[model samples]
Target: MVSLRKVPGAHQHPNLPGKVKVEEDVNSKAVPVDQETMPTIIQTVKEDLGELKKFYNITLSPTRFQKVEHYLEKKLEELSNITFGKLNQAGQVDYALLNNYLKSSLQRLRSDKVKDDEVLKLVGSFAFIIIELFEARQRIQKLDFQEVAALFTRADNSARDLKQAISSGIFRGKIERTIAYRTAYKLEELSSVLRDWHNFYLGYEPLYSWWVSQPYATFQENLSILIACIQTDLVGFDDSVKDPIIGEPIGRDGILADLDFEKIAYSPEELIHIGEMEYQWCEVEAKKASCEMGYGSDWRKALEHVKNMYVGPGQQIYGIHDLAIEATNYVKDHDLVTVPEIAETWRMLMISPERQKANPFFLGGNTMQVSYPTDKMSHEDKLMSMRGNSIPLSRSTVFHELIPGHHLQFHMIKRHRPYRRIFDTPFWMEGWALYWEFILWDKGFPGTPENRIGMLFWRMHRCARIIFSIKFHLGEMTPQECIDFLVDKVGHERATATGEVRRSFNGDYSPLYQAGYMLGALQLYALRAEVLQSGQMTEKEFHDKVLHENEMPIEVLRALVRNFPIDPDFRPSWKFYEKN
Candidate 1:
């Protein structure tokens, strides 16, 4: 489901010239380390380190890298205080100092000449290490919902800092700028929504307090700075630009100029109104549950009850779940021919609650376990309390997250040979899940009227998000307007809609949700056509190829595919893979 876009022109990494020669001479052979040879403990440690290294190399910006280093220093210091059998005082100090030196080395590279592409490549190589570190930190932290929420706030800040740094140093061309700008605007809407959400959180002071108590102070502080930088840059853009669809400045008049607007069955205003109502309905349901459960009830339990109430005995909800299961079964039935290694590796990856706490992005909601390939006895015992609840907007989300989504993606990455780093792109990761939702629906799995209604509702939600994101970023709407849009158009309740709007404002990156999903779907459709024309592979083959690559930006996927060697005798057909 990764969206593919060409970079337009080849651009070399800034530091490539100096390092290429040296790197070429250092080590070129793919290390062939046997997974079975190493002791279990050592192997686990090695894998963890590898994942951490990968993440650091790809995504670490100088500002964020420094933050991570500081965090590590603090953590090591904390460990020093705890009583442990593994190491003496001197050993602990040595460990801390070693980490200090490693961080310092990474810091020194901040100024080292390197091309953006090269940096991306380096990140890919060491992404596994970053993943491991992230997972490990979560496991050790045992973070709850409140703590996870705080981390998201911090993540937003880190993201801002990275974006600002990149923007200052690099001049993206007009096309790239336009794309980035539009995307940013969408994110702004999402942030506004999130802010509303924060306001709602404030209503429950105890929960809010618990969230603030997490180790996110630094993240929040840094985020504030990052937001300022973004705002400054955003203010410079001209807002009265002419619309492409209508040859006039984008405004109420411009929207009226489009012929399609009149032809469409639903008006924009109508859609927004629907969204608002749905949101309110959801809120009413939540409030009723809250009162029943008591004011200080466990948020997790409360959320589960709410989800179940929403799901009810509807075909739409149940059908999507069944479709998701079918998708998982298809993969299992074929042994995932295109990516068998990934299928094999699924049995080894464990989903720990601590890890979920550490990474807000991976938090499991309303599910006893969100995502785990191997259901060991331990996992089985820890049954998730949130199963068979309300249908999340993303249909593929259930399959991808719980059944085949995360688990399948992770296994593919682990087993990939000459592994192209695909896990580096969050956009594609989420997009894949969303894409699967529709894929199942299109396959006729969710055929009931209720399921259809649910699907339409979900679509409406996404559309509202897109519109909200665009209007807010373009300065066409206020935060309140964004809230109104969600509540009115998307069928969200007033309170819930308001919360979503606030979330958009405060979080600032929610637009990526729609952008990623839309982009992924577009690219997948295009790729299917390309493969058919070439007559080189079956649909199943292409699908396997796509999944095998795991989750990567569309552009990166295209590059890999363009360079991929396919059998000349292979005849492309959708039927290669089972439809159902």
Candidate 2:
């Protein structure tokens, strides 16, 4: 989700300033005192790595990969030299995090190299020429306009050849076809780089533009044609279609690699099973709510009733505002978690029709953007948008975006152990918000059957997310299948379902992101059970401790909160979920 700090047309509260105050609250009991040493070397390593990455910003270059790999190797050596016993618990935590990041970065670089190699095979001849031009520009080399023109000419011919070769059916299978589609996008990116390089000297250096203009134009056209051919002929993409989702699954091995990076010990198959189990639970709960709504076992009908309970046009803002106020009051009244004064103040805005395609609901961090029907939308789209952001649905989502969700999290991380910001995982971020939903449900926040159905809708959606997202990445489900699953199983509106599926596999979010909500919340729920149930910490203390620790893998936070002995090479081993 895109975080909006300031919006031009946002409805600003007079009390909430444009610039938020993020200073430490010394008198606040919410924040725990830092008793452990700060890892200064980790900061140094971070800066050094930042400098290295800034210089080698090009994507998928072997030279870039090798240089980065070498840099990480040296950092690993430096990390190994640190004496684990000398550091405090916090320092040891940073050490473990850095170690994990270095190892994961290295593994990802290697994996990327394999994929890049395949992509280059499809676009290498022409891409290499453009890459050299950019590299030379980066080095401040004098432009050889005539030679550049010749190079572009060669690239244009090469692109044409490549397109013809691909169209000849050499790349026929699903795997090869997926690679070809990816190659098309890579060509689009290369064209952008070409445009930037051309615009850099187009007007300033007259001779350079005059000599290279025709060739550049020819090559850009050729690249576009090649890209279109790959999409249309090879990938069977139709431009007439709206929001065509062409997702390439990474398969089980890639999913395993991602899980390893996130310190999740569970297998992808096991996670899907967990999703199924959770879905079954939500179904039972939904049926109970449906019966209370006089709809018997047909929760879908109950869901329809809730959807139609949406506020009228131009009235969504008030409903959303009231929901936020209600959630704020509930959390504060219950002493669920420490609510920062700043988190309580947030600006509200309407998501544009364009952005609504990707984010069809509330998007919050510092600001909450409500998705509602606009004057420009068609009749059907207007109705879909209204139903998707209905009062009952917005009830559960408001707090998830504001208050104890992303909004409070933004302020909390800035105030506490901000350096651990690099180790931030969606499991902690999205999971914490979703965890609040679980807490609220248990605390009877959903007083009405409609509200419970609404809550269950999102809960089941998260479950479906885990199932569809994992299955998609495992090559067992397509994007359309995922959308259908959301509509059929979770009772989402079709347009809303399309947007959710599009955003999931649109390459913006991590493969595990959708799964993170429920899985991450479940981890926290389990920890809450372990801590509060055992009488080690009160509810407020447990919640406060998590916020103070800042962001890291929930498993790491688990070890920290449990006061487990810190080790330099700690890996996540807590099997938080049981099959039964």
Candidate 3:
């Protein structure tokens, strides 16, 4: 992994009002600044910015940098009245000030250089810092006990909101294009920072060693709670549709042709088989845990309690009694994919508790770390552990979090070199994951009525998430109201609902899952039709091409489709698809 160097301190910005001077007599380094020399700050800022622009080669022309300098200068002038104490002492960096600085800088660049790519990239970098400041403020706000439990939840939601804004804004196109050009560079920077954070705070190796080694149980408990919260809240919630063909048992010719699955260095059938075994293993573990925890004499009671506790009224909860019947019926009625690729992938990845603890983002109550292998089984572990009867609601979470969703989307993006930007764009990554839930069903794994209901239950959860995110962030509802709405509308347990509300307060990113899922699916469906009708491609060919090309913005996808050569006899007008 590439690592980014640490950004210099605030005083390092050459444009600041003072310069360090060595005083031999006093044997001290002092910043010398007086009214007479103050004008130099502006010139220095300009010169420094110029150097940065040149170093990055942001554009072939110096004109873009010149424009940015002009705007930055004006912003600094405006901020002159804004005292550092006032801006930074609010316990956080003032985002309003940061936004003003960014806006001014971007506007100036836009006026001078019409290249959307350069302007958007610079804007994105600036926005990243501003977002970090906002997040830091949020973290500080959670210093108290009550707020600490909610911190991770809030961070997850905030990330979703920030990604959504970036995806939907007018700047998305430019940002996407520019990101494609520089994602690797940025990822390197992020990796370095993450390493430092891990070493300094999380402690390397043995998973949560730092957390466990803490002298105070309160601290450990707090960390554990935060981890649990994030895992439950943020890991899996995509709303996009999967390509039925991709999930087929025999594997479609189109999929084969498009992907060198052969080159993936794994067999699809073997993958699915392993997933099934893992699933069964998880079921056994859950039952053992439940029995030990004493949910009831049998696993059935524990399963029931888990369902009633987490599932909302509108969703379906398939009991063990219905499992065999449903499975047999589904196999008989549906064109089931024999490979079980998704299931296999999830089972292999989620069985280890160590893997669960490594991911900080998976801290929430119902996170994939806790839910995946156990959803379909009794809460045996919880029972054996003698903990509360809180079964993970979205137990099939690994399906959404790892294989056939996030993992798949991420790996697919990495496959195509030119479309690497897709990984950088959270919207594409998240939206694609959400869309896969329905797609898996459509491909025939969950075909019985019971299975369908179970699937619908998951969908309802996502829908509720959408409503909650929009209402909560837009101020249409209070945090309490949000909690009530989730419970009343989605049938979530009070504890889960309350967790969701608390999480919402800390961030604004939850809405993107629904929006992206819905929009991305629509785009894929329409694009598929266009490709098919053009007689230039088969379903397999189109899907192969699309997946192989990676997770570009819908607009970019459309452009690529339009440019794809096709037979005149089969050609279809692009007018069929509606833009969001």
Candidate 4:
């Protein structure tokens, strides 16, 4: 049966200063902010927005920028008329982000130097529709199939016309054309949601067929033809999307380039070798953990023992709240990074089963969702849900999902420039969490041999993820083969492995994301050797700088940290992993 889960507004991250609408009640506690001086600053921006207007001019040539300002300013005013007063701190941050978005459009237009007004206006429409779509969705209430489908269809067809313009114009080397493509990707996401709603409601939504006959029919036809053209012209059908780890297409050599591993770019075979090496190292550590647990030096036995402790007798014996508390103590005690005051107030909730098919593990952002099963399922699924999330296997990432991982990231990004959130990639989001595992393991955060095994298992899993995802993008592996590799090599439960692969291929994730965890960690680690290990900055100082810089590709980050000059023509030249 299709689960009746609907996509909510682009997840309103709990930690950020924002108003949220959730499927269930959330903490009513206001998101904390250091508003002492911010009110004055915000007021100043509100008064004239001189600072933003100055950037608008700087981004675009004085000659061409005036028209952009004239176009965008009118549209922003219309949106502000509708949703201005309702903004929470998070909402204010998004508003600032939208300002950056407008400025960026002009900057991109200037850089591309494309004088085609039609293309410029169409691309410009994407930025506005994106802002409006989020605002409209936030105003919606979850109810029946009829109301939900109606609400989203209106959102869809309205967006479809604006997006169809760039469907065929996405040529190679034109990076900004992806603005339209990514916007279309979001449209497809909504369409998929409606399709699922069509199935879940089972003819109850009267307009289901009605939509296909008129608006949706036209929208979808255009979408299909465009995607087919894009596939033939740009990225392939069964291949990854355009953006690689850094920010361009992941050509055969592009993955290494994106990861800053291009200076000595490894061949596919060598890349796979790195994964195998990590897997073997973890297996050896797992045996030691088994010995410490009195289970003998058999990895399978150690896994069995860990799995049993977590599942026990069909009920989850562990509480995620308790886990968060334990993680809080460990992170603070170690002083790896200062746990900010707002982090203590970050909340946790359970992920619904309908949502878990794509995310078998935990999902974290401003608010953290601890994964466990909630649906009516067979005995085997129940066991897989429990065993796959066994305490030892899950521990290394608990604090990672919360403290120094996403919640803190969400908090920092909002308070910092807020505009830089555009540069975020999975490399930074997922990589930082993975990097902490390295830091903890180095600092003896793993107390016993078993704890070490637990931590090392996650590291091995990240390495395997890079190998599988990159090969899939290179068109060398099938999804089934990816699943089998995870089950056989990473010791994932079969069902869990399937979910993992599904999430990777789904439109929600980019090609670089799965690789981002390990590859991104390596990027951060290499920089650490240059900075932290080299005594240019303490661990706290280095981490603080990264957090404040907000999330961007690591190559760009390296330049920022080193105070190297960059411009619109900035290319990935850091090559952090030259030797290995």
Q: Which candidate's lDDT is highest?
A: 2
> Which candidate, 3 or 4, would have the higher TM-score against the true structure?
4
In model 2, state the lDDT of residue 124: 78
Off by over 4 Å in 4: 1-277, 291-297, 311-318, 565-568, 578-580
Where does candidate 3 stray beyond 4 Å?
1-368, 372-396, 501-505, 508-514, 533-536, 564-580
Model 3 lDDT tens row, 1-580: 1112223342121211122121122112222322312224333444645555543243422333544455465545443443333322111112222323334346435543544344334434322332232223222221122222233334334444444444445334444322322332333333333334334433443333432233223333333343323222222112352210010111233222211211112233332233234334334544554565475334445544555443222122232113323433343354322213432232222333223212211222122233222443345532321121122434234355554455444455555433233123333555455455555555756433323334444454455554554444343555567668756654454545554455444323332333344334445666666777888776556645665655444444455555643221121233322321
Q: Write one digit per residue (lDDT tens) for candidate 1, span 381-446.
A: 222212222454234344656444555555566665213331244445655555555556556645
Q: Provide the RMSD of all predictions against the true structure, rounded to 1 decimal.
A: 21.0, 11.0, 21.6, 14.1
Candidate 1 C-alpha error for residue 223, in Å? 17
RMSD of candidate 1 to the truth, in angstroms, is 21.0
User: Among all windows of ten consecutive residues in candidate 1, which has the lowest summed lDDT?
Assistant: 17-26
Please, what are the lDDT tens digits per residue for candidate 4 over residues 165-227? 335454444544343344334345434543443354346545444443344455456555544
* lDDT winner between candidates 2 and 3: 2
- Pick out the ten consecutive residues of candidate 4 with the lowest summed lDDT: 23-32
TM-score of 2: 0.91
lDDT per model vs. reference: 0.41, 0.82, 0.38, 0.58
- Backbone clash total for model 1 is 84
Clashes of 2: 0
Per-residue CA lDDT of candidate 2, range 14-84, in tens? Answer: 32223122222222222121332445555655676776666556674544676677777777776676677
Whose TM-score is higher: candidate 2's or candidate 4's?
A: 2
Better of 1 and 2 by TM-score: 2
